[model samples]
Target: MAPNRGRPKNLYQFHYGCQLFPTETRTQKQLRLALQARTQAETGPTLRRNLNRSNRSVKAAEEPTPSHPQTGTEQHDVLGFNEGPSLWEDTEEILNEEDEVSRARLRSLHQEMIEQQRHRNWKDVMACLFPAYLHFKKLTSNWTVPNPFLNLSSEVCACPVEAYKERDVDLIDLMVAAIDVYQSLKSKERKLTQEVTSTDQQDVLAQQSCPACFGVSIPNNDSTEPASEPADNHQVFICLDGNFQHRHHERASKNYIGIENQTLFVPSQDIESSNSEIREAELAKRVTKKAKDRCAEQHKAADDRRNASTWKGCDDTGLFGCCCRHDSVIAFCNIHKTGEGRGLPMSIIKRLLNSINPNVQVGVLYDIGCTLGKFFKARGLLTNHLLRLKFATAVFHSYVHDWPCQLQFNPRYNNGWGLTDGEGLERLWSYLLPLVSPLRYATRNHRISAINHRSLFHNTLGIENIVLTLKRKFIHALKTKKESEGIVHQFLQDQNPHERGQKYTVEFFRAQWQKQRKFEIEISQTNREKKAEQAQFYKRGEALKSLVETLMDSLAASPQSDPAQSLSLIQQMQELQKLQDEEAAKLGSLFVVEPGAERD
Candidate 1:
């Protein structure tokens, strides 16, 4: 297209011969052209040329580049398509891809195992079996190998350790192999079933349907599917406490070595900040006072020695000290530790709660349950976990607590705890004493393992006993019910002819309620009378104070210069003391006893 002669001269033109006229005045057109020229100068051919100088510099900003440039050999490290094919590398990649697929399949199988309740520790069991499977496969290379399900235990026992060693297989390796094998078997079975079902459907479809009707009725095969297991509502009771087993450790006194060393104290998280600070200040003050007293004693002794022997060379020796060895353990479920033992039990409790099913009712019995409850309430710790928790003290421990504490933490009052449940930890300790001697001689790991194994064995036996007891109870209940039903029926038939006893009547219940109300009123009246008497009773402190004041007054009034007057004053003070002792005896007669303070 040709430019129009009638258009403004201040217009733009393209290389394709397209022309555009300016819409603004001459000054605006000039300014627009100037701006365009400046922009072009800033980001035009020169800028593009600069960026092109190093393709790497621009690309490097967008992506990572190695610090040291690669040589030809380094670049060729990874096999290229142009190079000869590497069978081993290709095989490795294929195997890795297969392994990933197998792992996913195995996870599903493991979940199935757990859901079926076939095994609690399916992975560990499989780990122990996989090496045997491998050995069997090697031996039966020319022949067909039987499935592990036939006799997995026997195979495991027969398989040599050498087979595992040859393949550099460990327990973990065995576990992985087992998973892969299970996954493969499952996939193969699934594929075969799918093929069979498909072929059967095709064959049925190929045959002519009933001429009169349109559909063929096939019997449903899904009726035999196993019923799903119910959710576990088994209640678990766990007791936690510190058991101080005195095992000698070489490094028990490592932190308590020298005279200048401060007390081997660990700041506790359970203690309030103010209380901790006060304790620290008190300890420091006591240490300072002790040091002063020691210095005074030393100086006095030195002076005495100098006076006695007419001193020689000055001796500058100060006090020397060594450390003491005594270790204390705080344990829960036979798992013990020696350290700052405050929060260790709390951590173990938290872990135990988390691992169990959320619906399980957990009753924790501790010796200091009341104190722990107060601490937990104050701090709002374990708030999320208290939903199904029942906190109680052990039966024996509860006897030592105050009335209010017993009311809150006594297991007798707690409906969640079963008979003898709270005593489990105590029973475990009794069993543990026999095995604990080994801990003194064994390594730390060995001690832990021994305790754990013994605990496990005890738990297993306890479970068996519980199961047997329940079974026996069920049988006894059935037999007793059957035996009593006939006699009860005959008795009821006989009683039907006569009126029921007055004990079952509404009047009897009304009378009982009235009697209870009267008893409660009487108790309240007694409590009120006791409280009033208590208010009139003189406190021991007040009685002592009065006696002291009277003696002070008598002493002040006496004339100190005259011996007769002083003697009389002394006799008067003695008489006052005698009177005070008699008054104290009277006050003690009305002493209110604190609960649990009575001697056993």
Candidate 2:
């Protein structure tokens, strides 16, 4: 297949300047990769610097002293994988000199391959989309029409289709590509016409918000309304989370850069800036050798303690996402080296807020929202928009936080939250879970595009059935409200005696919640629930000790020495020890236990 000259008449005729992937032969990919490898080898030492390895090699080369014997630099982990230089910090730059060199080389090679002056034959056109496949409507070719389907569509299901389609491994990818291209083209056309699409990049809600939430929110009185509340916007719940499972390996693509930028993702440059800004600020003053939120440092995601070493083979270790209460896909980005960190979420949140009206009240629900809220305030992030935002933990994960944290951040305990669970992203992750393993080996462009495309599909389906969603929510809420009210009324009518002979009313609980919130505010981030627990621990321990001592004295006085008596005493002692242990745990839970702390 000889390549034709002059861009091969961009058959799709995209006047909006939208370019599709060209067809290409295996020769092109092979040649391009070969040249890239040759360039890297030519500039290898300087471009691919290995400071740690070089230092080890140099030390081994030198004469060894009796006190310090020479050691092999080559080491393997328990898994028998070599422990090479992995990106230690989340903020490490991915595009090094070698990366840039390879990227530039590929770009130049593509131009040369497409317009190879002499040839104008079928063989040279091997890379273009095969089947000369065109979206019936858009006429975009899958390949320029020579290129071995380099980008494989991610399998949402692991079931093999080789038996059905024969040996063209990327057949599924080819078929999916046409549909994806059509959808993208369709969306672009809609955007141009100013038609509302279910899948919007910025997630700008052109239509009305969820009916139950802010649609009919009552307007506060003039005096009580926030100064920034221009027209009494109802509260918006935005959930942010990170999924470490959605990662792609560095070896997946060879010096290839994805040309089609995915708008669903936060821009990489913005990611870098957020990371740099946060680092600079922390370095100057707020740097904590000992992080205030140890759980945050230990496990970035909620309860999932997958650390840096977990993704030794991957470049993108995870993803950070932001979404509305309806579980619609909003802005998200591939988290560089870290699991769940401050940079990506903050960047996404700030961008979403900036894109829309400042008057829109946003409540951000994260697994560790209470901790993040404090961090944001301390770092002076979102300072201007702080008034419009409320931070809260998702309902399911709220139990992980102490009572004080629950009072402040748990949606269930808070007023105006209604029935928002804040676990929307968790459900969203399940939808994308199928893309995890397959995408780990796919190209960077393929990974991002696949996620964005799938997310778009999710939103489209969600929008189409939004009315059904509202009806179900309304019915569920009504049932829950009735059942809860019945229980409350039953308790109110009960003759059960009160603790202090005082009546408990709804007003009493409301005032109590306000008082609890005030106390939480007065205390620092670490101090919440710990002081109360500590006091309780000492008081309980003293009482238990006194009781044990009194029982032991009584036994001694009787001088009882029977087998049955000894067994009874042993049982009683065991119960006391268990009680003491539990009381001690209350205090222990407040502090962050470092690795190997138990052994120490």
Candidate 3:
């Protein structure tokens, strides 16, 4: 083809200016030349602006809008492109079309994505695809943030979602971790707040003290003082009304007058108009004194009744029937039935009773371990007024033995007196001996010896039995005076000191003497049995010795009686027998030895 028509002046001018004075750096220019040569080689040849009218219109449509002539230089610079005006404009149009397509595609992708990337203009497009997208975003925006209690770390989030999804543990696990931290912080806050509130309330409650009786002083606004005091005796001062005060005074005045008085001693004016308050005060003092005396009498009567009512009982059927009294009445009452095993101290009993009821009469004494019937019999006799009217009627109850077999024999008693035999005698001595002696004596030397002696005496006599006897004798004395229908003094007068009389009559002594006699007879019988056993053992020993002697005599009288020959034969036999005995002894010793001993 003849040289194609040269490009139009505008197109040629554009290409010539780009090639002659390229806008790109040297490296860029070289790259562009290489790209241009590659494109030209692929296409074979090309001419500038070779287009039909339809092509021209489409190309023009692809171009970007021209910058406005009135636009400022800064606006023009911001709009600058590396390519010429037409190419730059075309690229801008393509970019604008691509953005529009992306925005349109996002609307159909997901409403959530559209909202997340809200900067793009997708509202119109999204409304077409999803009508409720905007509303959903608005409603859920506030709740979008995850709970802080949940452990929503990336690793946790990426775990096997299916495993936890059906179980609901994922959310619970998240909440649990989050809540632990939250509660720790919240608990500290709550504790601090409670402390502050409690302190405030305590301060308020501490301010007021009792206004009456002065028994309790109200706390000052800022002072720390206890609410009550024992010594305070101040009377309460109430602000009484005039009418109340008048009534009080009238009552006081009436109380002061004698019951026989029919009329006022003074004129009505003097009696009614005179300040009644002064006379009322005097009347009050007399009434208070009378009331105090009545109260004292009531207290004294109560104490007397208590003394008469307190008593215990025991039986004296055993060999050892010596009367013993416990020091503590209350302890006796508490552990009274404890017969041979553990005996309560009379002193401890007394203290405990006094502690429980201070009005208890300590002088009204009774041994805790006594037979039931004897105690009642004593009570019946001692109740008479003619026999030692000042002393209160007292009874005794017996102690029980510790061992079940002993307790079975003495069923009425419990296990408080002393142990049967001497198994736990040492323990009992350690526990009780100190209590019996004076504190000073106990603190001094020989404490252990004193305790052992007490235990031995107690064990031998059966402490419960002894305590019962003394209680019985006292009761008997009272009974004799009652039955004789005479005062205790009169009964004593009847018995002459010259007649070798007992201080107290012994109505129950026969039973005690009989028991003692039986005890002696039993002891003698036991000794006889022991002697018989010893004789039998001696007889057995003599029989064994005689049998051994008979065996030796038989051996000595054997056959072969030639003096030298028999002696030699006997010597040989003796040697043979000695050897056999030695082997047998060794075997017997070894067989008899115990396995344990062998190991040792």
Candidate 4:
């Protein structure tokens, strides 16, 4: 290309100098500058002028600047390429405008990214909902109405969407299908009801019962009287307890027709100024007395309530009724906290008792047997059925009670309970908690609905009955004479057995029980002796005081009393005083107190 005439002359001149004396070749620019200055000082005006010219030339070659023909402002360019304009030469207004545009572009891009991410999240949610709905549909397919989805909109079928987009008809159909399925599988009479009503409906004809379902073949309640058995055989044993569910956030109570009916009173937060001094004093006295009385009553009730137990940290009470006979939950209620004792569980127990035959002995087992026992005994409601009623404590809970209580109420002593204890209720709660935990935060109605459905499903589904049926079949198969003979032959085929048969008879258990009773008796005697020893000290002190009083009375009557009698009285008094001093010293040392302070 031809050299441009408009280009700066210094640009070509600087290039020529760079070719001659390369700027980077010099180790130190400062050294070069110093040498030029020294030569300038030694030489004449011509040499000084040349050195000054060279110094300017070298600096220009090291960091050369190019400028536009129109604007004289120095500029930096990439190689020989010319950009439109430099910020150094541009006006401040133009620079500010560019910066503002850049920020706006950045913000727009950021918003677009966020929108894309949100759309992706919505799609994922819809995908999950579709599979869940399909699962529900599959579960209810057997009982669902014909062509439940026939009336669906094309848009609904086109893609997975949010629940709100579905037509009301579809939602209603889904709900109806769910209800139908539940009803089909559920027992005709809810939990133990058929048996309860069998007595009243004796006129009804006997019908074949389905083996796969939880049903009874008997129709007449007249035969409801349990077959005569040993006193140790019980028709049923039920365990009861309460479970409390916690809330993440507290909400104000909603008006409902359920059990929680007590009106709660909250103290006023706002305080008002009082004018009368005498009135305030009297009011304060009354308040203090009322508070003290309330505290005393609460403490007494707390001590009494140990006979029954409630779930820890749970304010809401679940009065569970578990049948130890069947190892299943028979009935449960979400009970309101009525009073100190387990009023709800007790009521439920009575209801359960009424459902069964009056002649059938029923044993009740619970965590708090002591409290329930006292309540049941004192209520007079069960006085007529007292002979049929037996109460015992759960094995796991017996250890927490006093030794006397353990001996009386422990399941080990209750032969009627047999092998299975009352812990069936505890196991039921464990299975139920995980299923209901997620629904807890929902409305109370929703939470209760879910729990009721699960409980009912477990009861009517025949899971236990199916297992029982299989067990009976297996036993029948094994009971055949051929099978029994074959098994016996197989067993005898072996020359020797690795393990021997172990058997424990009633006599063995009876002997063990006798030994246990004797030990318990010895323990009681020891306890009584220890208590008597404590009482003896107090009794001696009291006797000495009485003697001293009598002696003084005699001395008053006869001023010249006998010295020996007087001395004896003094010695007794001294002994009593010494005993009191020793007791006080022991008490002071055992308990925390201020240093040097007398216990009395």
Leading candidate by lDDT: 2
Task: Give the alpha-carbon lDDT of every model.
Answer: 0.45, 0.67, 0.32, 0.50
What stretches of model 4 exceed 4 Å from their correct place? 1-141, 144-234, 246-320, 337-340, 461-512, 518-600
- Candidate 1 C-alpha lDDT tens digits along 48-73: 88878777676767866699976685
The sequence of per-residue lDDT tens digits that candidate 2 reaches over residues 114-206 is 533212323344224322333322232434545535434332235566634445476775575465555555445544443454334223443
Candidate 3 lDDT by residue in tens digits, 546-574: 55555456558875445665455456556
Residue 529 accuracy (lDDT) in model 1: 52
Off by over 4 Å in 2: 1-187, 193-204, 207-232, 283-291, 294-298, 302-306, 495-504, 512-600
In order, how many clashes per candidate? Answer: 0, 37, 55, 3
After superposing candidate 1, which stretches have Cα over 4 Å from the reference? 1-234, 246-248, 251-342, 471-600
Candidates in order: C-alpha RMSD to true structure: 29.7, 22.0, 41.4, 28.2
For candidate 2, the lDDT comes to: 0.67
TM for candidate 3 is 0.13
Ten-residue region with minimum lDDT total, candidate 2: 11-20
The 10-residue segment of model 3 with minimum total lDDT is 238-247
